[model samples]
Target: MGHDQVVTSKGNDHPGNGPAVSREEFDALFEALRTWGRWTPADRGACNRVSPEHVRRAADLVRSGTVVPLARPWDTEPGPDNARPALHYMSELGDAEAPEPSVHKDFLGADYHGKAVSHLDALSHIAYRGRLYDGRTAREAVGSRGARFGAVSALGPLVTRGVLLDLPAVSGEKWLEPGRAVHAPDLVAAEEALGVTFGEGDAVLLRTGRLRRRRERGAWDLDAASAGLHVHAMPLLAERGICVLGGDGDSDVRPSPVDGVRSPVHTLALAAMGVPLLDNLALEALSAACAEAGRYAFLLVVAPLNVPGGTGSPVTPVAVL
Candidate 1:
């Protein structure tokens, strides 16, 4: 779909999903947004935009010195949202053989790419037309071990200014209802409402109040319906030169605006734009902090586990102000 075919926000009575698009149209979009061969290390993708100066500027935003973590509790319970719940079990329950001193131990693991765990997605995590971010062949780049090109280890320790686009605050709704598509207009309206603007190397976070909804109501199938960016919003974000993009719903509106694409935003940001993604972040506390501070931007830090060749990592990102 083109700019003319853009879908408005939930308030517009749009069909939730926008116009039906052919594979050719989606390919046109993919080609238009690509940033291949722009940087020396292709795996770092748009993360290269964040320089040391950006980090210093971000740290300057820490006025109150209050910190808020963005990851939800590591979910071990089965729910409608988490099909494969993360594993947490005691390896030793205060019964180590070290004299009278006992030790407590546990193991943690998860297929964190799903709707449950808050995680950061590297460029190799998504492929379009059999290729990764720099058009490297996915089959060859991703071996039996993990991604050879865009490993999570490559994009290490992202620190940048973060902007929270809290749509519910602008709409006066608890959350954008499931299956709603957030558009460029919605982002602009949010920027206007929150007194923040997208800037170079910024970590743009879209908060649809998914956690608040789940806290009040219950878990619904995100595959069926979820509020997130539509493909039409990519051009604006790309022009702003975002270093990272994230959201509560993996950054794609469900029943995708484009036909035959389940996660168009992922394809656009990761495969096309080479921008890493943070999925399933719990932004309620961050939202409240921003509102309390009367500002939406803050110093955001993402330190993913240094997993070599891993496509992504479970992360506990934090916002400070």
Candidate 2:
């Protein structure tokens, strides 16, 4: 089917056996990767990404409600390290003397006139050069008419391996200190200690375990948000061929382990490289699940809004055994 075709029902590709991707589909993906000119060096790095068939299978399970999706709670006053928009909704609208329609609204509603936070970043969210992964420019992707890819809506559906790194557990500390950069060594050590190696297409989740403390202290300052990947760490992850990098911290990169730089991770990973980074994820549940399973690897699924050319969206991601 063409990209424009809406996959109305779940499991449309593999009707019976859930969405387990077939080897044939994997081969097709390889073919596309080899032939597609828009594919970047970073995209080439992601060529080993978990097969689409894998994603389909996970989505099938998610649709069945067999996989419990942990809802991401909005952190109204997330500390300095982590800060983003909080979704809200309103059930009632106009005043007693006002017009008939009562305003029932979501903080960012999903109606024609309203806006809702999207869950995924479309390929257009960050382009390598002047164009997107599919060779389309940001200007071509956006317009007064409506939003498209590169917007929150273009990323069709994201699915792959999701891995979590509990930094505090690895460091034997209560929390990774704010402005303290997380290095590649820390990640490697954590992986060794946890006995998990992030695969090429894995969606890596980093848990600083600081956000919980921040919430407990009721301080939403930017400085309190810990758990960020340092600038040097970006290349490490890129070399590993990781598709997505997420954390409970403010950004994926800090200036250095000692220097305090903000949003460096966004610039290096999202801007410099084409790797999409997920921020402010509620990874407590995910961490628990991985620990319970005694395994850090699992099927991950995330579907971005198909808004033609949007930026980022709130992703509804899930982990399955």
Candidate 3:
């Protein structure tokens, strides 16, 4: 496939400036990709998921505020991909008859490791055309021993200025309804309310208020999770040079308003523009912290699992005052 073109619902194009994703940025991005790439079942490539520079930034943010954890503890069973209401997964307990004490438990019997809730979506998490990012293929990356990020880990810790766009508060709604999407105007309203302006290298966090509202319903359907930066917010973010996007809702939107579009933001941001998406974040505490401080922009830090060749991993990103 030729370079895929991504457009938002408002009818705006979001092509990246060029192929150059900057060595500095690549250093931080490649590490996360290897650990989380799906095609790692094919061939492994050497790359750094995070950069030292990013780590320093995160440290700076932590100094300003407390490090609020962002991931929910993983359970025995994983949930479906759609924005479902409740997550269901299996779990294994240490039964005396189950296995010998000598056997080490490996990520709930899967070869993968790390806390389920903490992770990063390496660029390898999504791909365009027949190749992974930079034209690497799964068949070439996967091997008998399993996938690898080709280094100590696939991604490194990320640090940057973070902003929160609280949709529920701005919309004057108790909460964002399940399946409802927060648009660009909603974002602007939140920014104005908070008196914050977006800037380059900013890691943005949006609250659709969907998860808190829907998870209680017991079962989530197509409308369970809230929609994100679709046609509504992508252009505004890209033009402002946002490096990462975070949300309490799923990063991709389903049943798009556009007939043929399937979560265009996923393609437009990660593949076309090299912008990373952080999802299912536990932001209520952090949001409260920001409200108390009367500030939104701060240092943010995120670290992903080092699982080579994985899809999206759980993530924990917190904003420091």
Best by lDDT: 1
Q: Can you write out model 1's per-residue Cα lDDT over 123-218, one digit (the tens) per residue? A: 999998799998899999999999899999999999999999999999999998877778898899999999999899999999999988887777
How well does model 1 score by local distance difference test?
0.89
C-alpha lDDT values of all predictions: 0.89, 0.53, 0.53
Candidate that would win on TM-score: 1
Q: How well does each candidate superpose onto the true structure, as a TM-score? A: 0.94, 0.66, 0.66
Expressed as tens digits, the lDDT of each residue in 143-216 for candidate 2 is: 67644544444335667767778888777776665445677788899999988888566778888865565555
Off by over 4 Å in 2: 1-48, 53-71, 75-87, 91-119, 126-149, 223-225, 253-262
RMSD per candidate (Å) reads: 5.4, 14.4, 10.1
